[model samples]
Target: MASAETDSKSLFSLESYHVSEEHGFILPEPLEELPPYYKPWMDIALRVPELVHSHELRSHVNKMPLLSSTFLQKHRELRLAHLALSMMTMGYIWQEGEKNTAEILPQNLAVPYWEVSQRLGLPPIITHADAVLANWKKKDPDGPFNMQNLELLVRLPGGESVRGFFLVTLLVELAGVPAVRSIPTVINGVRCSDTEAVARGLEIISKSIEDMTDALRLMQVYVDPSVFYGIMRIYLSGWKDNPCMPKGLIYEGVQTEPMEYSGGSAAQSSLLHCFDELLGVKHEPKSASFLIRMRDYMPPLHKKLIQDISLQPSLRNFVQQQDCKDLNKAFDLCVTKLLALRSYHINVVSRFITVPAARARQLREQNHDSDGEIISRAPTALEERGTGGSGIMSFLKTVRDQTKDTLLPEASKEVKHHS
Candidate 1:
């Protein structure tokens, strides 16, 4: 009986060994660095909780030369990453209504922020997609819906204003996890060099992208354009104050400070990044491009898994080798869906930004006297503009056409010309 027990133990050990060997060895990937500005503020928030409540820490953040053209030119990627974190942190806090008044972001931060955001072609407000992809978690020890503990875990040094943003962030994670989680399975299957496995993986990823896209679309109605625009307008006091006004908008803190800089838009969405990675697309290199540094903002393990999967033999390569038209179609379908979602956002934001700008122009023109002497009137607040008009529909269609032209360059010219 003792001999049998020993043999059983040995057999179990042997099976474990074989399994390990079959899987092979993969060194754990290294962690990416967080944006430099993030850690300092986080350290201060952790060590001195009271600092978060005052304007002191915010003043210090404003002092950073994150928005200077020279600095941005030098630290393009890191600066953009920092700008996203800073704005989201501040916007999430201030929008919660902790303090009752609107404050302006100082010029040092405001000008460059607007310029950079424009250069990147992003909107000033944090979109549903941005919050979802940036803050989603694979595992939550606290129940997924538990807001109090989640606030503790996410720990931005803001007051109750963060609650709504936090809730949205949590909702995004809950909505997106199933799709995000399936990514690794797809990666591993492709690594196994099994054509069936590859096909299954492609199907799963395509479906995952579609589901996430649907979840993002649902947010369109829930986001009140007026309220969102109102909040953003209050933060733009510095831009209003600037003689260079309409060049772009700047976010000034509500707590009366002289600091100013540019950039409050949600950084490029992580879903976009995921698409780029999976499709093996590359954009121009900057000192620290969004594609490269955005990973710093992701949860470490999640980022690592994405990196690992990207290094695997690409799905595109596999499709080519197998001559799989179906797989190619699935991949193209995901891209088309993503582009459609982007078009939707462009339409929505054009309503928010372009619609207001157009209205303000019309009001100014209407106020002009017959002699061309303008009768001065207070500018209409963006929120007060009733949601109306085709509002940049033409511009959006042009953008869609350009995107299709760029993304589907190889398709028969007739399809491209149909528009």
Candidate 2:
């Protein structure tokens, strides 16, 4: 119901941002491979898992031809090229695991990857954009978009768990579709003072967020915690803020100095960023800093959408102005659902990262005959922090707690404000 004038003022719609009505932020009909000329990249890309498994990925990459980016003409072609290059880059860097990271990306892989990344406005490293958005294809084109039918186009060190991790994350994005579709209704309803429309929109968003939390449980069913903690996780990690590659990566042909970029993260997903702005969820300085930096990793248009949403009139203020109980309840429910989603995310992180890390620590303790002999400094990069380099447990808890703060107090719920 948002008018053209309102939409123009806001600078976005789902259509403008490539946010799909059905798939939310998931890229539609993603190309599985680039044109025939880019097969050298594809050849290594499709073999990422096998090469990593055999410990020959670096040797193979060293032998790769420095292919040109000129053949990538279409939008999807560039997407696929970026995907191939990103996976190859991640594999090449971490093929020997985190302790033995390759600091310099070979020119054979770096040049065209850099070129394609420049064209796409993405960093020349694996991001959530590469690992999740551009990495899926359907087992059956006409089939349902569920685990059985969905597949990853490119993979890293993790086996089936890699597919599970990325695809389940993809499904979470899919689950967010209805919430995204209802944003305009919330904004427009607030604009027109249509309490009922605003309430309806808020309810849809609440239910959709709940559905997103439910979709997150799929990680338990599909991803092996040990696999996620040990194998696939390293591939997603970047040199920035990481002790492993302290100087960051040198894209051999592109720059003389090392460039830093964070690893792929859930923060890179625009769903929560958009929701945070629309609903006004305030994060603490530490969490807010990481969250804001993540916006830089997102596609420019997607990042702009969140910025535009923040610049608009506040939905929370609009709800605060209304004394209608339905509007009050709707706003409350939306924030409550967001709070629940954040809590659920913490649980998932604990299951996937926290628990595995603790067990690994205990194993390390056991492996050492004496506790004094247990070396604690190494493996701490991933063991204590997330791939994005935030202190994992504290960061998740902070975000979850901040989400709880957005809920309106019971006394304020039905009060008619004069201001």
Q: List residue ranges in candidate 2 displaced over 4 A.
A: 1-12, 368-378, 411-419
Q: lDDT score, residue 64, model 2?
A: 86
Which ten-residue region of model 2 has the weakest summed lDDT? 369-378
* Candidate 1 overall lDDT versus native: 0.41
> Which prediction has the highest TM-score against the true structure?
2
* Per-residue lDDT of model 1, residues 228-341, tens digit only: 443333332222223323332225532233333222222223444555566555443431243354454443343554565467677666555665566556555555655565
Tens digits of per-residue lDDT, candidate 2, 1-419, equal 34446545643356777677777778888998677877778888999999988999999999988888998898778888888889988888988776788989999998998998889888888778878887899999999999999999988876888889999999998889899899887877877777888899899999999999999989999998877886678788888889888999898989899999898899899999888999889999989999999988877788887898888788888888887888888898898888778889988998888887787787676775533322232255688888888888899888877776677777234332411
